[model samples]
Target: MGRTSDAGEKILAAGRSLFEARGYSALGVAEICKAAGVPKGSFYYFYASKEALALAVVDEHWADQRREWTRILSGVGKDGGDAGGAQPLDRLRKLFEETEAGQHAVQQGCGTVLGCLFGNLSLEMSNQTEAVRARLQEIFDAQVEMVAAVIGEARERGDVTVNDSREAARSVVAQLEGQVMFAKLYNNTGRLSPLWGNCLALLGARAA
Candidate 1:
């Protein structure tokens, strides 16, 4: 395959920012072009259509998010070493703390609670397009897998009592997205704590 063009990366980056700032329906092909500083022809050269680009953005954004997830939840320390030596519950707390910190940054920078990208797209386009909806479901499933892996590690160490790590992971992701949606509606990050608290209780991941 040919090397990825610089224009492709720029367009995807711009699309992510704009699509996150506004929903899919609100942004058009022309607007994406302008933000990306690329011509109409250039966009089609990389992506077949706006919808196609949206899928690519989801893939790209999730790749970046997953790396962070691995770093925090997987217990990889700054020097790329295993700090998984920490209790699963402790690692879970640190991961959620990091997630909260990131949301706080987005809230400050965007001047509003911009909820999870996957959640936003899931709500907006899940019923609109089968392919997009399928892609999103896959992303959510991958999220569950990631969380479940962490939970399994914790479980093996006797830190988490849950026998069904997959189910528990699903609940955690659902609650997270639900809290994010609430934050968006209330325009406050304060709602996250109680929701998170409930998850900690349910998963028995609370600190002593």
Candidate 2:
């Protein structure tokens, strides 16, 4: 049973990498099975179809992202906190800095999974795959809500000029997605550097 589970995980990991490197239309079940070293028969045993596997991949990816965001946010004022003595906005900056470092570490700016999956599917599957699109939308909505919470805190403390947390949150979330899209188009993460300050300014924080 453990070996079977491991095999399934291997297939999911391979699928994720392929989907990240090359958008959905470019990756097929056969290629994923080949990369995972799993037989076609075994692939069917795990996932009913390529679309099913894609859904699983999306679920896993968003789950992992939520956990990562939780960890970063939770660490702000807890024991062994990151960047002691930093304000909430500074901590948020650290979060982006860490993300940028990870992107550079992988030698691919902006970590293409979120951008590739959402961008490709939004364009290609809008009419065909409503379920997939809805799932992706839910993940994005959750992220936007998280951003709103952060901005709401800033507003409470008079750190930002935004009158509506919800609107500010949406704007910041849109900017983030736009930045990722621009990074993907340009094949460079540096396009996001200037926008970081712009985000701070939007939050009424002085540029650091």
Highest lDDT against the true fold, candidate = 1
* Candidate 2 structure quality by residue, lDDT tens digits, 1-208: 3553567888998888777667677877888999998886789888988888888988887787777766665445334556462455655665566555545555454344234356556666667777888888888788777777777777777777878877877776677667767766776767667666877866766443
* Native-referenced Cα lDDT, model 2: 0.70
Model 2 TM-score relative to the real fold: 0.84
Give the C-alpha miss distance for residue 139 in model 1, angstroms.
1.4
**Candidate 2 — which residues are off by over 4 angstroms?**
1-5, 76-80, 108-116, 206-208
Question: What is the lDDT for 50 in model 1?
Answer: 91
* Candidate 1 CA-lDDT value: 0.82
**lDDT per prediction?**
0.82, 0.70
Weakest lDDT window of 10 consecutive positions for candidate 2: 107-116
Question: What is candidate 1's lDDT per residue for 113-161, written digit by digit as tens?
Answer: 7878889999999998888899899989988998888788878877767
C-alpha lDDT (0 to 100) for residue 45 of candidate 1: 92
- TM-score of each model, in listed order: 0.88, 0.84
